[model samples]
Target chain A: MGGSTDSGSQNRLGRRLLTERVSGYWLQGAGYFAIVLFALIVLALLYQSLPLLSEYSLVQMLTSSNWDPAQNQFGFLPAIVGTVYVTALTMIMGTPIAILAAIYIAEYAEGRTKTLVSSFIDVLAAIPSVIFGLVALIVVVPFVGDYLAPAVGSSATGLGIFTVSLVMAIVVTPFMISLSVESLEALPDELRESSLGVGATKWETIRIVLLRAAGPGIFSAVLLGFGRVFGATIVPAMLIGGQTHLPSSPFATGQTLPTLIVNDFGELMSLPLTQSALIFVGLMLIVVVWLFNFSAMILRQRLQQRWQF
Target chain B: MDRYTEQRLFGLLARGAAALVVAVMVLVISVTIYRGGRVFLMDPTIVITPPGSRYMLEGDGGFLHAVLGSIFIVGPATIISAVLAVSTAIYLQSDYSSERFSDTVNMFLNVLWGTPPIVYGVFVLTVIIAIGARTSMFFGIVAIAIFQYPIMTRYTDEALRSAPDSVKEATYGLGATRFETALMTARAALPGVIAGIVMGFARGIGDAATVLFTAGRSTNMPAGPFDGATTLPVLIFDQAMSFNAEVRSHAYAASFILIIAVLGLILVSKLLAGRYARYAPGGRHS
Candidate 1:
C-alpha cells in the first residue's frame, strides 16, 4: 500500500478510502434487499395463511384431500397432486417437441428456414400465457371436446389436467427450445467435425455425442420449464374444468395454490385462518419452486464441468 | 445416386417439418390479428363520431387505455432496472474473478432468471399490500424492476465478461484506475447490454400476473405513483372474464398490441445478437 507521512494527509486518505468503500452502497445492499424481500414475502404469506392452519391442523390440511373453503374443511392434498400431475404431464408433452425443434434449428436447419423458425420461437416466447389461456378456453377446449376427447376416451370439460398440461406445454416449449439451442450452440466446432469425420451419420452423432454432452444443460432447461408451468396461475385458473374438491379424474375440475389464493382470499379477507391457510399453500409453492431451482443449479454445475467438448 | 436420394428424402422431411412449424406460428399470429383487428375493422358500432353527430359513437376506450397504461407502468420500471442491473454487473466485472462473491451473485441472478414471474408478482404484492403500498403504481414499478433486474444482471455480466480481456488489461497496465477502465473501455461495449435491457423491458410488459397484483385495477389514467391504474394485462384479464361481449373484443385487441410490441423487442435483440456474434468475435450473444 502507498504510505503517507503527514497525519492530516493520512486522515484525509483514510476518509477518502472509507467514502470509496461506501460508494454505491446500494449495489452491495442488493443482497440484503433480496433476502429481506424474500423473508417479508414468506412472512406475509404465513400471516395470510394462519387462519386456515388454525382452523384445521397441518395434518388435516395435508390429509383431508377436500377443499371446502365455505365448509371450513381445507384439505390441499388434491390440489397438490393436481399441480404436480399437470407439471409432469406438461413436461412429457413439451420436451420431445422442444428437443426436436432445438436440434432442427441449431443443428440442421440453415438459411431463411433457420431464421424463420427462430423468429417463430421468439414470437411464441413473447406471447403472454393469458393469451394462451384465452385461446385454449375459446378454441382449444371446444376442439378438444369435439374432436380430441371423442377420438380418445375422454370428454373435454374445458377444465382438466389434460387441458392445463396442453397449455403449459405451449408455454414451456419455447423455454426448453431456447435453452437447448444455447447449449447446442456452445458445442465446439471440432466435436461436430470429428463425429462427421468418423463416418457417423448426423442423427447418430447428434443422439450419441451432442445429446450426451448437452445432457445436463438440457436437463436444466426442462427443470426451468417445469418451474414455469408449476407456478403459472392463469391457464389453470381459466381452464381447469373442476373447481370444487380435488380432481380425481384427468377431466375433473381442480385448483392450484395460486388459483386457490385468488379464489378464497377474495371472500375470506376477514378470516385470518382462511387467509393464513391460503398463505400456507403459497409457502408450499415456494418450497416446490426452491426445490426445482436447487436441482437445476446442481445440473447446471455438472453441465459446465462435464461438457468442455 | 445414393447421395442424391438421401438428400432428397431427408430434404423433403426437413422441409415438411419446417413448413409445419412455420404454419403453426403463422396461424397463431393470424388468429390473434383477426381477433384483435375486429376492434378496428368489422365492428361498425365501434366507430367513433362527433358527439353531436348522428353518424356513430366510439368503441369503449378500454383497449386504448390499457395499452397506454402498460406503457406507463413498464417504461419507468425498465429504465430504473437497467441502471441498477448494469451498474451492478459492471461493478462485479470490474473485478473479474472465479471467486465466491461472483459465484454468489451469479447464483442469485440465475435463480431470479429461472423463477417464474408469477411468483415474484405474488411475493411483491404480498409485501406492497402488507406495507400499505397497495393501490400505488410505485409498488407496481418496483415489482416490475424486481423481475427485470435478474435478466439485466445476467445479460450485463455475460456482455462484460465477454468484452475482450486484452482491452481491459491494456487499459489497466497503463496505470488507469478500475473506474476509468470500466467507463472508458467497458461502457463503450454497452450496445449488447442495452439490447439485453430492451429484452428485459419486453418481458416486463408481457408479464400479466406480477403487474396485476402490484398495480391495482383502475380504469383511469395513472395520475401519479399514488394513483390507482390498471395495466394491459389486468385490463385483458378483466375483459376476458367479463360478461360483456364488447369488452371481449377490446381485450383481444389489447392482447394483440402487447404481443406485437414484445415480439418486436425479441426480434431486435436476436438481430443485434447475431450481428454482434458476426462482428465482435470476443463477445458472447444472449
Candidate 2:
C-alpha cells in the first residue's frame, strides 16, 4: 500500500476527527441535561420532605385520615385513596369511549370526517385544564347538586369525587383518543389488507390484525391518560369540595394529592412542617408518576416480545 | 346474529361512540363560547384595559395585566426551551449517543414529561423560598422553561426520527460534519420542530399549575421579570374561586380569551406544519 505523507491531508483528517469527537461529546452533554434535571427535581422533593417524615412514621402518613394541620395532624391516607379512586373511575368512564372513537377514526372514518375528528381531539387536548375546572364549576356542579345526586338515591353538594372524576374523564378523553388513534394509524396497511383478503370483514380485520398490532401503544396511551388524571390539579381542587376526609362515597367530597397541595398551599407555607408536608405531597406525586412510567416501559417491552405482531 | 349483522352492529356502536365524543367536545366548546362570548360582546374593553384598584372586588377593570404577564413570562421561556429541546433531540441520534444511552435519556424525558406541573411548581417554590426570593416572573419563566423542555424535546425527537433517512445519508456522503448533518436533517424536520415549539408555547401560556405558586397573582401590571405577575389561567383560577358573580363573569371572559388564543395556536401549528411539510424531502402532505 502506497501511503501519502501529505502533511496538509493528514492535518485536515485530524481536524475532522477532532471536530467529530468534540461535537459528539457536546451533543451527549446536552442529552444528559434531562437526566440532570430529573435527578435535581427528585432530590429537591425528597430533601424538602425530610422534616415531615422525621415527625411522623411513613405508615401513619399513608393510613390515617386525620389531616387537621391546626392540630398537627397530616394524614395522607385520604389523598392517596382519593387519587386512586378518581383516577380509576376516570379511566373506567373515559377509556371505552376514547378507544371506540379512536377505532372509528383510524379504521372506519375517512377523508373529511377523519381530519375533523382529529382536529377536534387536538383542540380539546389543548384546552387549559383551568377552563375545564371553571366550566365544570359553573355547569356540572349545579346539575349534580340539583338533579344527578338526588336521582341516585344520594344527597350531595355537587363538588365531590364523582364530579371530579366526570370532569376529569372529559378532560382526559381527547388526549387518550388522540394517542389511541395515533397507535391505530401506525399499523401497516398490509395488516388490514391481508386480513380483509382472507374473508375478514372490516371490523373483523381491525379486531384481529390492527388492534393486536397496536396493543402496546394503546396500552401506553391509557397509562399516560391515567397519569394525566392522577396528577390533575384544578378540576379536583375546584370540584372535589376539598373536604380532606377519606371519601365516604363518590358523592362525598374529598381531596386528592394535587388538590391537597393546592388547597393547602396559600397560607400553610409559613409553617415549616406544613411546608414539608406539602412538599412531601409533591414528592409522592413524582414517585408515583415515575412508577407508572417505569411500569409502562417494562410492560410495553414485555408485550412487544410476546405479541410479535 | 350472523357475523355480517354482528359486524354491522359493532360498526354502528363504534360510530355512536365517536359521535358521543364529538358531541362532548362540541358541548364544551359551545358552552365556553356562549358564556364567554357574551362577556366579550358586552365589553370588549375588559381584554384591553388594565386592572384598576379592587379589580376582583368591583370587576371594574380588564385583565390586561394578565395578558401582558402571560406574554412576558412564556415568550422567553418558549425560546429558551426550543433551543434546548432541539439540541437534546438532535443529540439523541446515533451520531452523538448510542441507542442504549439515548433510550435511557428518553426514559428520563418521559418521566419528566409525565411529572405533574404542580410538582414543578412545588420544586420551584422550594427554590424561591430557599433563595429568599419572592414569587416573580423570573421564576415563572424558569419553571415554564423546565416544564416545556421535555415536551418539546419529545416532539422534536419524534419528528427527527421520522425524517427520511436518505437526506441524512446524502449529507454525510457530502463530507459534512455531524453538526452540519444534524442541521440539514433538522431542516428536513423543520415543520415538526416548529410545531413542537408552538405546542410548547401554547402549553406554557395556558398552564396555571406551573406558574400558580411561582408567578404569584397580582392586580398590578407587570413591573419587570423579577416582579410578581399573573397569567390568564391563574386569573381565571382565582376569579372562579372568589365565589362572586361579577368575578366569575370575568373568569369566563378571561378564559374565553385564553381558549381562543390556545385554539388559534393549535390551528396555526397545524397550518404551519402542513405548509412547511411540502418543502422537505418525503415530508409532503395535503
Candidate 3:
C-alpha cells in the first residue's frame, strides 16, 4: 500500500540504475579500446610492410644481406643476422651470471643481506636502457676498441656487435635476475630442508633439487631476457656502428633490426620500397618478440600448474 | 673432488657472481656521475641556461628546453594513460565484461607490453604523416600514451584483481550498482593505481625511441602541446653522436638529469607500492 505512494522515488531509482548501467558499458568499451589499439598497431605495420613484397620476395628479403637505400636494394639478412647474433651473445653472457646471482640471493643470503641485494637489483632494473647506451658509448666502446679488439686479433671499431651485446647483457641481466629470483623463492621449504636432511651440501641441494624443479621458470626468465634483448633499440643504435653488412665477427660493426630502423627511418621515408622494407623489419621484430613472450607465458603457466600440483 | 671441497668452490663462485652484479651497478652509476659531473663542476651554465638557447658547438647551451619538453610530453601522457588504464582495469574486474573477453584483452595487453617502442614510433609516425600532421608534442604524447598504456593497465589490473572479494561483496550487499562497486574497489586500490601511474610516467619520460620520430627535435622550448620540442633522452642521443666535445659534454649533463629524474620516480613508485601492500588485506607486514 505504501509502495503506490512512492512511485516518484521508484522512478528516480530506476533512472539512477540506468545511468550506472550506461556508464558501466562505456567503461567496458574504453577498456576494449586498448585491445583495439593493439590490433591497429599490428595491422598498420603489416599494411606498411606489404609494399616490399612486390619488389622482393620474402625469402630474398630475409636471406640476402644487401640493404642499400640509394640502390633500392632492401635485403634484411644482415640486420636479422646481426639481431640474432647480438641477442644470442647477450643471452650467453647474461644468463649464467644472472642465474647464479639469483640463486645466491634466494637461497643463500640472510635477512639484511637479502633485502640489500634485492633492492640493489631492483634499482638496477629501474635504470633506463638509454643510460646503459650512454655508458656503453662512452666507456665500453673505448675499452673494447683499445683493449678487447686488439687481443681478439680483429681490426674493428669498438662500436660493433660485441659492444652492443655487452650493453644488451647489462640491460637484460636485472630482468633475468628478478624473474629467476621469484621462481627460486617460490620453491617449498620442505624440498630444501629434506635435501639437507639427506646430508647433502647446500650447493648439492640447489644443483640437484632446486635447479631441476625450477628449470622451467628459469627458462622462462631466460626467454623474457631474450625477448628484451631482441627488442632493444637505443643501445644498439649507438654502439653497433650503423653498418648494414653481415657481421663477420664479434668486433665487426653491424646493424640490428631496431638499429637499422632507427638509423634509416628518416631517410627511408622518402623512398617507398626502402620504407616498406624497414616497416617489414618492424613486423619481424613484433613476430620475434611475440614468439619469445608467448613461449615464456606458456612455460610460466606450466610452472604454475606444477607448483599447484 | 670431495663433497666439501666442491661445495666450497661452488659457493665461492656463486657469491662471486652475486658480487659481480653489485660491482656492475656501482660501475654504471659511478661512470655516469663522473662523466655527468663535469657540467656541474666545470660548466654550470649548460644546465642552468634559459630556454630558446642554441645547443651548438660554439654557443652557450643548456638542457632547460629539453628538460621542460620532457615534462610537458610526459605529464599529459601519464594522465591520459592513468585514466584509460584505471577505467580498463575497473571494467575487466566488473561483471560488465565476460571472463573470456577479459582474458583476451589481457593477452593483447601483454603483447602490447612486449612490443618494442620503436614499432610504436613507426606506427604513430605513419598515422600522423597520413593525417598531414607535422611532428609535434601532440604526436609525442599520443605515442607515449600508447607506450605506457599496457604497463599501467597491467599494474592497475593486478591491483583490482587483488581487491578483497569480501569488501566487494559487502559493497554489493548494500545495494550498490556495479559501477559503484567498481569505483569503490578502485578507491581502495588507489595507492597501487598511483604507483602504476608513476612507474608508467617514469618509463614514458625516459624513453627515447617512442618520441624519436614523433617529436621533432627543436632547440627552442615547446610553446604549447602542439609545438615541436626535444626531450632529454633524444638530446643526449643526438649530442653524444655529434663530433664535437662540447656537445658530448652537454649530452652527459642531460643524461645526468634524466637518470636522476627517472630513478627518483622509480624509488617513489616503489615506496607507493610498498604502502599499497600494507593496506592490502593479508599483505606482509613492514
Candidate 4:
C-alpha cells in the first residue's frame, strides 16, 4: 500500500509490479505443494512396492494368512482382517456414544455444559496416540488379563484385537464427536422449529428430521474416524503383543498393517524383499485411507452444498 | 414403551455417554499426572537433568535429552511448516485463485491431512534410503513438517475463507495488489493462524511414529540436527516397552512433561481463537 504509491519514479512502480508478479507465482507454487506432496507419497510407495506385486498377486497377499518373513511367506490376510476387526469394534463402540453426545450438545445441552464437553473433546484430541498406547499398555492390558478376561472365562494376556480396539475407540471418539457436533449445529433452526411446531417431540424431531438432514455429515465423520482407526499404529503396536499368526479370537494377539510395518520395518529394512513387503503394507494403508477420505470428502461437500443458503 | 418414557430414557443415555467420555479423559489425565508426578516429586529437577549410562535399565537419569530433542526437531519443523501453510492458505483464497481450483486443492489437502503420520515417516524414510542417508534429526524434521503441513494449511484456509470480504475489497479499493491484500487478510485471521500453528507444534512434538524410524534413538545429547535424537514420545515408547520397572516409570515422567506441554498448547489455542474472534470484521471492536 505504501511502497509503490509513496515512490516518485516510474522505475519504482515497475519494480513493485515485478515483485508482485513474482510473489503471485511463488504463492501458486505454495498452493501446489500439497498436490506435489500427495503425489510423491503415492509414487514413493508405488515404486517401493512394485517388486512384491510382481512376486505375488494382490489377492494372494490379501488372502493367505501365513506371514513367515524367514520362509518368504508374505501373506497379509490375518493382518488385514485384524485391522478390519479392530476398526469395526472401534466404530461399534465409539459411534453410538459419539452421535448421542453430539445430539446432546446440539439439542439438549445448555451453554455451560456444551462448552465444557466440547472443550473436553478438544483436550482429548490434543493428547497424542502414543500416550493412549502407553496408558492402555499400563491399565487396560493388565485389567483385561488379570480381571476382565478371567471374568469372561478366557485365559488372555490382554494384548489382543479387543484391547487395541477398546483403546482406539477412546482415541477416535473426539474426532467423531467434534465433526458430528458441527454437522448437527449446521442445520437451520427452522428445521427444528418446524418439527416442534408440528407437534413432534424433541427426540422425535431429532430422530426423524435433524438426524436425517445431518446424515451425510455424520456418516462422513464416521468414515474419517474409520480412517483414523484404520491407520492407527502406536496403540496397536504397543498392545497387539506382536503375534504374527491369525488370531483365534478377540482376546488373541495380532497386528494391523500399520502395526506390522512399525514392528517389523526397523529390523527388516536390510532385507530387500521384506522391505518391499513392508512398503507394500504402507501402500495398502494409503490406498484404503485414500478411499475412505475421498468418499468422506464427497459427503462433506454434499452436506455443505445442501446447507449453503 | 411409551413415547415420553422412551424420550426420557434416550435423553438419559445420551447424558450418560457424554459424562462417560468426560470421565474417561479425566481419569487418563489424572493417572498419568499422579504416576508421573511421583518421580518428579522425588526429584523435581529431573526435567532439566540429562540422562546417564544405563538410564533405561536402572532409570539413572532424567529425560532432558528427549525434551531437548523434541524441541530441536519439532521447533524448526513447525517454523518451516507455518511459513508454507500460511502462504498456501493465502494462495487458496478466491482473490488469488478460482473456486474450482481451491475446492480441488482442498480435497487433496484433506486427503493428505487424513494420511497417517506413519505413512509420512515411511515416505521420508524411503527418500532417505533412496538418497543414501542415515536416520537423523534432520530427516525427522522433514517427516514431521510434511505431516503437519496439511493440517495447518486446512485450518488456515478455513480461517482465511471466513475473513470478511469487505476487508479484501477495501484493500483493493486502496490500490493494493493481490499479495498485499492477502497479507492484510492474514493479519485479520491471526487468531486462527496462531491456533493452527500451535496445534501443529503440539502434534509434531507428540508424534512418535512419524519419527520412529526417521530419527534414530540416542542416549547422549544430539550433537547436531543430523545426529540421532529421541523425542519425548519416542522415548516414552521405548521406556514403556522396556522390561525394567524403573524404565516404565520413566515413561510416566516423560509423558507427564509431554502431556503438560501438549495440553497447555491446546488450551492456549482454544483461548486465543475464542477470545479473539471479535477482532475480525462484523464483530465487536477491540
Off by over 4 Å in 3: A1-19, A299-309, B48-54, B57-59, B271-286
What would the per-residue lDDT of candidate 2 be over residues A167-265, giving only the tens digit for each residue?
999999889999999989988888888899999988888787787789999999999999999999878888998888888888899899999988888
In Å, residue B222's CA in model 1 sits off its true spot by 3.0
Better of 1 and 2 by TM-score: 2
Per-candidate DockQ values are 0.32, 0.65, 0.65, 0.78
CAPRI quality level assigned to candidate 1 from its DockQ score: acceptable
Off by over 4 Å in 4: A1-12, A297-309, B274-279, B282-286
Per-model TM against the reference: 0.86, 0.95, 0.93, 0.95
Interface C-alpha RMSD per candidate, 1 decimal: 3.5, 1.9, 1.8, 1.0
Q: Which stretches of candidate 1 lie over 4 Å from their true place?
A: A1-24, A31-36, A43-55, A300-309, B1-20, B42-61, B94-98, B267-286
TM-score of chain A of each: 0.87, 0.91, 0.91, 0.92
User: TM-score of the candidate numbered 4?
Assistant: 0.95
Off by over 4 Å in 2: A1-26
Kindly list the per-residue Cα lDDT of model 4 for residues B118-165, writing each as its tens digit: 899889988988898989999999999999999899989988877778
Tens-place lDDT per residue, model 1, B73-152, is 88989998887787677767646334677776676666667666666766766576467565568777888888888888
Residue pairs whose backbone atoms clash in candidate 2: none
Q: Second chain TM-score per prediction?
A: 0.80, 0.96, 0.90, 0.95
Tens digits of per-residue lDDT for model 4 on A203-236? Answer: 9988988888898889888888888899888889
Q: What is the C-alpha RMSD of each candidate to the true structure, in Å?
A: 5.2, 3.3, 2.7, 2.5
